[model samples]
Target: MTAGQVSNNGPKPLQRNLSRRVSFNEATLARSQEPPKPPAEPEFIDTEAQVVSRPPYSACCNSCCAWTSLVLAVLLLLSILVGGVYFAFLQSNLPQVRLHRLDVYYLEVNNTDTDTFLTSDLEVRLNFTNDNSKIKLSYSRMTASLTAEGVDLGTVTVPAITQEPSSSADVRARTWMRKTSAEEAVAEDLRDNSLKHLMVIDVVLKGHIDFLVNGNKMNGFPIKVSCRSIDQSEIDNGHAPKCGVQMTPL
Candidate 1:
């Protein structure tokens, strides 16, 4: 074919459309074949900074130290005050208090009611001599324990006893020791009524106490309270003293 005949058979519209499609395809191909670009570098901050370290505060520590100092000062003051008081007490109350002699004069016990042990009464008489040269015992405290038939009954507190300087003083006290059933105490051991048969009494005269220098406690001479008898000659000779009263059935 001739050149003019081939050009006449070619499609003009289709060729224009094919050329646009090839242009888009070539742009896409070139974009897919290109290498990726690196990311932009991060921005650098160029700011001047000031370093600051907070200083320690001692408000709570100072408060605690002040409180501890106050407590220690208060404790030291209290100790000094107590020591001064103890020293003053020692200086004022302590004195040479001597015990002379405590002698029992009389003892009485009556047990008329065997069933009721509380209706009984007792009277004890005592004498004390003051042998101290510096101090005089004006008042005394005496305690006595009573027992019946080898059984402890009760205790009795005597009143104050007074003795002059190098002189003897008499003391007497009478009271009931309340319900003291000596028979009930020993009922488990002995079946028979040992308490009803006869009256048995044991009296103990503890050491006499004297209030020296007003209220200070001091020792006094020892004495005994008993219902046992003694000879009249011995009593007159100041040896064995006789007791006037004895025990009665309860």
Candidate 2:
């Protein structure tokens, strides 16, 4: 009925509403300042709790599942790409060395009518060249020897005369093994014993190749001249026996 009483009663509803609004605003502000949420709580429905699931999924839940699947797929793809990149990077650092091809030839001599060809006891020619344009050859002496029907004639080093990159030139190397007239007679007798008891000849050669052996270029592939002795009668018939040598190119 009085002025103060009327004023107090008139503002009571507005004051209560204002206070409620202020409390709500304060709660919203506190939520903003709070640390990030600890992710959503997983919903697990007990099978025993009689609950019916519809055929069509809830739209919100379907959208969340789809988003989760997309994120996992992206992560998987990123991991695979990173692994592939790492493998390629590792492969580039590995060493890749190649070898060159080498060829060897054999020449047989039994009887010679010309005296000019009697300079050496036995001569063997060989070739070492790079068939690939990208590869180069690095080697040491070529050691070759002779064998007659599983017999050791001898072994010697093949000297290198010249090397021209244009056409792989022949080294024209020679090997000598001393043989006396008595030795010749014995060899002839042995040959006469059996025609099929043919002689076996082998030439073994090796040298320092481009590859490092124990951290040295002087150690590489071993040379081998394993060939059969050509027919001596062919040489007596006025024809040279075929040279039996192999090629090795680095």
The most accurate candidate by lDDT is 1
lDDT of each: 0.49, 0.47
TM-score, prediction 2: 0.34
Model 2: residues with Cα > 4 Å off, grouped in runs? 1-120, 160-167, 179-186, 189-200, 211-219, 229-250
TM-score of each: 0.32, 0.34
**Residue lDDT tens for model 1, 105-215:** 222233444642433344444455455545555443556665544645457777665554567665554445545444443533322322222333445544333445445
Please provide, for model 2 over 104-198, each residue's C-alpha lDDT reduced to its tens digit, 9 standing for 90 to 100.
22222244342211112445444444333332344466666655555455666665332322225344444554432224444554445224333
For candidate 2, the lDDT comes to: 0.47
- Superposed by TM-score, candidate 1 places the C-alpha of residue 219 at a distance from the truth, in angstroms, of 9.1
